[model samples]
Target: MATKEEDVKLLGFWASPFSRRVEIALKFKGVSYEYLEQDIFNKSALLLELNPVFKMVPVLVHKGKILAESLLILEYIDQTWKNNPILPQDPYEKAMARLWAKFVDEQVGPVCFKSVVKADKGIDVAIEEAQELITFLEKELSGKDFFGGKTIGFLDMVAGSMIPFCVARAWEGMGIDMIPEEKFPELNRWIKNLNDIEIVRECIPQREKQIEHMMKVAERIKLA
Candidate 1:
């Protein structure tokens, strides 16, 4: 539980879309937090202590309590603030939201990253899997401004962070077109709309920097 005296702090890496998810949630909820940029390659002592098990970025420290994982942190933010609700009120809708969020994070996101970074070896298979995942999501998003219908919700936040910030950048860096505008018009529009939001505008990484970082990762994968 967060308190008035104890400050909210985020430990994150700039290049990680996972970290951006937490940032977007905090901003959308109108929560003021101290952002601590972590060097993921050489992690800081704070990050190490807070998330000793995973040793990863996107860790949230509130009132001296540590919360790891972006999704969990997002839910916590929504629960604590009670403003700009991210999750739906209904039980079933909330469950569905969680389902899609997990799918994007666990399945779609990994496949897209594999497609780009391992392009030389497994681009075809990875791209096919990614396309299938995107197609399913496109169908789910049909006739809606967002996955949550009217406004950006939990699923929107997760998908928005992964698609535009991570997958799109990976494809761009690899010189491939995964989500062609003509083929996936809805997804494209969703990306545009989500990014246009003020909180997202403040949190999303620069295109050039994302591409550069992804390209470097691709090169490393090739060498490995």
Candidate 2:
């Protein structure tokens, strides 16, 4: 078990999945730290100073060294604490984990969720595209308990944060079943597994607040 690190501080938002994932990683490592709830809608000077490039939440400040980007921060946490290893020991598996994690961040996640969340504007991203993304996931999850196998790992922290209630319920609220249990049993099972973990559930943002925040982000996108 990792002891409390007084120097480690997290600047995060309540409804940001990226933030939630960092929190999950921190809990997994059992590294005690300060949780600074940031207003992502209104970035603070500290957040701006820490991460001027993106000015994003989920910033991990350790020993006065600031790290931004959720994936990078997760890796830092794993390397720094060296407890509850998030990555696989096998190099091949680690590479594959990284591959899918990038795919989630770049290809699959945004294309699927942005379409539904930004529905108010005339955004008509084909539902088929979203379904295709889910199909890729369903296939990848075949015969495996998780993307990183039986235990949750780096990819789990990356993709799991994005694929749960916010995306599914957001699509459902739009009268679109993005992931039907029967059609995507493996993915659904993966979701169930993630949600079943106490720490993962604890880090999850409150449902209503999350949805409200999603709508606010959509509105911001519309006006922008």
Candidate 3:
């Protein structure tokens, strides 16, 4: 449990899924904190001071100590507030969760952007890679409401950041079906399950807003 005197502050960008991951974890843990929205284009002195190396958004400041990286922030939140634990108790399961979380963070962008946005690299290759990733997740989510089985857990939160936000909106912006109902039924179901959760849904940016942003990005890529 967080002490009353311990101040928790989150420096984040509004549309960043990485930042949203930390927000979801904090909300899930029922930890009260201050949220300082940052303008990444014009970096703030506070953000630079806290995250000197990366100077990025989604910096978690707890009782004067600063933590960077979304996954690490999530872990810190879980550890700080023992209630509503996110990671699994079993060591092996925890390791698996961390592995998938890292995979989602590293791969989701390239796989999603290349598939939907016009690029020198063909969309076919990106589609194949995206399908491979989705298939793995489908198998993992088989017979489970979430990656955590009954409830949302660490992997669920991490995967949730990518799936319905960037990937889904990218496909929508392209007017093509990537995760079709017939092809990725299990994965689609899992997406719905995650979205239905109030905490996840509340923090998610509006779908229309995401689509508009993605279209602008795609246009920029084309112009470049």
- Please name the candidate that would achieve the greatest lDDT relative to the true structure: 1
Q: Write the per-residue lDDT of candidate 2 for residues 153-195, one digit (tens) a residue.
A: 8888888888775666566556677788988999989999998
Best by TM-score: 1
Score each candidate by Cα lDDT.
Answer: 0.85, 0.82, 0.83
Deviation from native of the Cα of residue 141 in model 2, angstroms: 1.0
Q: Which regions in candidate 2 have their CA more than 4 angstroms from the true location? A: 117-125
Clashing pairs in 3: none
Query: Each prediction's TM-score against the native?
Result: 0.93, 0.92, 0.91
* Candidate 2 clashing pairs, residues 3+ apart or interchain: none
Candidate 2 is scored at a TM of 0.92
Question: How accurate locally is residue 27 in candidate 3, as Cα lDDT from 0 to 100?
Answer: 82
Residue 107 miss distance in model 2 (angstroms): 1.5
Candidate 2's error at 61, in angstroms? 1.1
